[model samples]
Target: MFGFGIVGLLRTIFRSRSLLWSLAVYELRGRYAATLAGSVWAIVNPLVLIGVFWFVTAYGLKVTFEDGPPYFLMVFCGIVPWIAFSEALSGGTNSVLGAAYLVKKIAFPMEVLPLVPIVSTVIVHAVLIVFLLFIMAVNGLPPQLHYIQILYFSGAMLTFAAALSFVLAPVNVFQRDTAHVIGAILTIWFWVTPVIWPVDNLPDWAYAIIRMNPLFYIVQGYRGVLLYDQPFWFQWPLDLWFWACTLFVLLLGSLLFGRLKPHFADVL
Candidate 1:
């Protein structure tokens, strides 16, 4: 039964790929539809935030890495993935509720709804990555072969985000508060994920606990590739743990979403 569910889910997603892409494009445009800056805000917002953190940590707090890239680069690598994930999570959590009209349509494949935001964020993420590479080159840190691992790491992040969205979207249909709760959780989640600070400052035990955060693997992976030039396999243990956690979440989300799907229209 479980095998069948997984297979069926994959088939559904594959069949709905066109619809998913269309919706994602629509969502991306809708995000900045009326705004003057439109899509430019995607790059501008993160840059502004990164500038603030760089100033505070580099100047005010006197934070520095003994044998690492500049502070801002570290923060940039870490926050890029974070911004993508957080946006995907927040948007995905409300995907179903926001598309109530689609949910009511019996012919629609609701699984794709959660994926819309993720796909939309991926477009923005690609743009940020290009900007990141440009910055790296300007700072004399030219791109290297190890940067290819970005594809692997990004695929992992997308899978993790999609798994989570599957769980959150259905719940939000029944409990409107789920979206607000997710926002609160993400705020705390961000601070703890080492986006602005180095994990080396933490005690061994604290590092262990923080490593358990699935996002830690992704943020660190981005840094490893862009800054450290370390391959994904360099941290095999964390890689295994991340995949294990992601698979578990994927299974749980599939189960929860499947169980809850039947009632989504009714609830909405």
Candidate 2:
């Protein structure tokens, strides 16, 4: 049953690949079409937020890291992936509802709805990564071969986000509050995930609990590759745990979305 579910899900996406890319591109352009700044906001928005956080933490709170790279770079590595995930999850959660007209069309593959935002966000994320590398170079931390692991971590992050969207997007169709709840949850999740803070400051017990957060793996993996040049394999246990959780969510989301998909047209 699970195998069929996985196969069916992959087949649906594979068959819709071209349509998916078109929709993703349309969505990306439509977002900033009216603004004067247009697509530039995609890169600017995250940088502005990062700048504010850096100033507040580094100046207001006097937060400093003595043992590693500069605090701004550390925060940037963590924040970049996080912003991408947060945007993907938020946009994917609303994807089905936002395209209500398409949902009413019988031939359309609704499964691609939630994936649209992820594809669009990846474009912006790629740009942000380049900016991050430039910042690192300016700060005297040249890029290394270990940076190649970013591809692996990025795939992991997108997979996890897509799994979550698969679950939340269908649920949001039935209950609009799901979107608001996600916003609140993301705000809280950000604080707990150690994006702006160092994991070393946490006690062993707290660190153990924090390690369970799937996002903790992504954030730490980003830091490991960008700052420490640590290979993804160095943290085998966490890597194992992250994939296990992600697969469970992916399977559950696939089944849940399949069960609920038939009703989406009715509800929307």
Candidate 3:
């Protein structure tokens, strides 16, 4: 069943590449198509958050930190991936809900809908990282050759998020409450993962608990490569763990979605 589902997903994707691409591009552009500032919102929002936090933490409250370029840079470093994870998960979670009309009316491969959110947001995320790179350079932190590892880290993140979305999209169709639970869980997750503060901010016992969260590795890997200019030595173990988890999630989600897919045409 798993093998057949994998084949189905691939065949659907290959056959609907044009459909997926068009929907993905349309969704992405529609975000700013009528906006006054256009793509400026993408850069501006991150900059505002970075500036506000940089002031409050570094000066207004005077928090101690271990990373370079001070507090703002650290937060921005973490925010890049956090934002991607947040957008991908949120958009992907609600993807099926918004796509109900299409699912009901069209005879197309349904898997393409879940993928549209992931692809569109991944593009925004890649663009966001470029802005981050510019910020790092402006702050006198030049890029290191080791930064090449970012590609691996980012690819892993994109795959993990897309795979997770497979399950979320299908589940949300069955139970709307999944979306609310997910939003609440992600809210708690943001604080627990050490984005605004260092892991050392917590006591050893508490830090251990925070360390168990998978999103921590995603945030840390980006910071490690882009900000610290270090290879992901301390993080390789976590990376292995995350990739393993991602693969398991993908396989299970595919199987579950496959088993349930025959009902989707009727359910919607």
Candidate 4:
């Protein structure tokens, strides 16, 4: 049963690969179509926010982190991936409704629709990673082979976000409030996921609880590669836990999306 479901999911995306890429590119282009800076805004917007956080924590609060990297760098490491996930999930939540014309009027594989925004968001994510590398250079941190784990972690992040979008996109069409609620939830999720703070600062019991969050797995995974210079496999326990939670969400979300897909046009 699980194998068939996995095969179906892969075939859905794979068969629609061309359409997926085209729609994703169009979505990314349309987002900045009217802006003078165009797609460059994608890079600028996050950089500005990172600068604000850097100023507030490093200078305003006189705060510092005790981890391997500098405080601001560590914070930047976590924030970039969080932003990607937030944009993908939040935009994806509304994606079905946003493209209602396609759902209601056209013959389309609705399953792949949610992924369009996610792919678009990943384009911006790739650019943000370049910015991350530049920051590391300025901080006198040379690139290491372990940085390659970023590719692995990024794939994981996208997969998790896609799974979440599958669940959120369908339900969100039925209830418009799901999108707003998701935004609020992501705001809280960010704070709890240790973006601005280090997980090490939490007490043992508190750490165990917070670590249960699926996003925590990706957030810390980014830090593990970028700041800590640790291979992903080095943390065997975390590797086990992260994949377990991710796979659970994947199955749940896929099942939910499949069940709700037929109702999408009616609701939209």
lDDT of each: 0.88, 0.92, 0.78, 0.85
User: Which of 2 and 4 is the better model by TM-score?
Assistant: 2
Total clashing pairs for each candidate: 0, 0, 0, 0
Candidate 3, residue 242: lDDT: 82
Q: What is the C-alpha RMSD of each candidate to the true structure, in Å?
A: 1.4, 1.1, 2.3, 1.6
What residue pairs are clashing in model 1?
none
Tell me the deviation in Å of residue 258 in model 2.
Answer: 0.9
Candidate 1 C-alpha lDDT tens digits along 187-220: 9999999998889889999998999999999999
- lDDT of each residue in 1-268, candidate 4, tens digit only: 6556656877899999999999999888888999998878877898898889889878898776454567888889899999899999988998898998889866688888889988998889998898899889899988887798899888888888888888888888888899999999998999899988877778999998997887888888888888778887766687787787778777877788878888878877
Question: Runs in model 4 with CA error above 4 Å?
Answer: 65-67
- Which is the winner by TM-score between candidate 1 and candidate 2? 2
TM per model?
A: 0.95, 0.97, 0.88, 0.94
TM-score of decoy 3: 0.88
| Candidate 2 vs. true structure, TM-score | 0.97
TM-score of 1: 0.95
**Candidate 3 lDDT tens digits, 14-81:** 89999998999888777778999875675577667667777887788886555455677778878778
Query: How does model 2 fare in lDDT?
Result: 0.92
